[model samples]
Target: MITLLLADDNPRMLAALVQLLQREFVIVDALASGEEVLAKSDTVCPDIILLDISLGDLTAFQVSDQLRRRGCPSRIVFLSVHENPEFVRAAIEIGAFGYVFKSQISRDLVNALHAVAEGNQFFSNSET
Candidate 1:
């Protein structure tokens, strides 16, 4: 099974994602802040990390960059409500494997995960 680490500030969003993805993926850890993600990443060593763009202590981009600097091999996927072209572009530039908008989670998230796991990029329709 694929291992995943989920980081989102909203408790409900985290819970909902966990519920939605637990069957298909093993949730190595679920955290509420980018700080926690950065701190726990080495230990959990998840296959993929679903990160919220707007985090409490650090932005997802910052976390992604730090993880890369630390040589973390986990694929990073940005989960955000923002559909701004800039945000999508930033995520891609940061080497994110996927970007799933919250509004289209039910429709696109699973497909995104599958694509990323297969070493391909997945972006919401609006982003494409």
Candidate 2:
């Protein structure tokens, strides 16, 4: 099973994601902030991180960058409501393996995770 670290600021959304993903993947931890993600990522050593693009204290980009700087090997997959092309491009530039739209989670989330876990890049179908 693929190990995952999940982070989102919205409590309801976070809980929903946990419920949705737990069935398919091993959820190492579900966090509520970018700082908490940064603090626990190394300790938990998840295979991938399903991170919300907008976090309370730090953005997903910041967290991803720091994780890279710290030599953490976890792959990043951003979750966002934004469907802007620039956001997708930025996620790619930051070396994200996948970019999943919150609106399209039912259609794309699991598939994206599978693709990313297989070392392939995945973008929301609507974006492609």
Q: Write the residue-wise lDDT of candidate 1 on 1-128 in tens digits.
A: 88899999999999999999999999988999999999997777788999999888899999999999999999999999899989999999999999999999999998898889889999997843
lDDT of 2 by residue, 1-128 (tens): 99999999999999999999999999998999999999997677788999999998999999999999988899999999999999999999999999999999999999999989999999995644
> Cα lDDT of all candidates, in order?
0.93, 0.92
Residue 126 in model 2: lDDT: 63
Give candidate 2 regions above 4 Å deviation.
none
lDDT for 35 in candidate 1 is 91
The TM-scores of all predictions, comma-separated, are 0.96, 0.96
lDDT of 2 at 96: 96
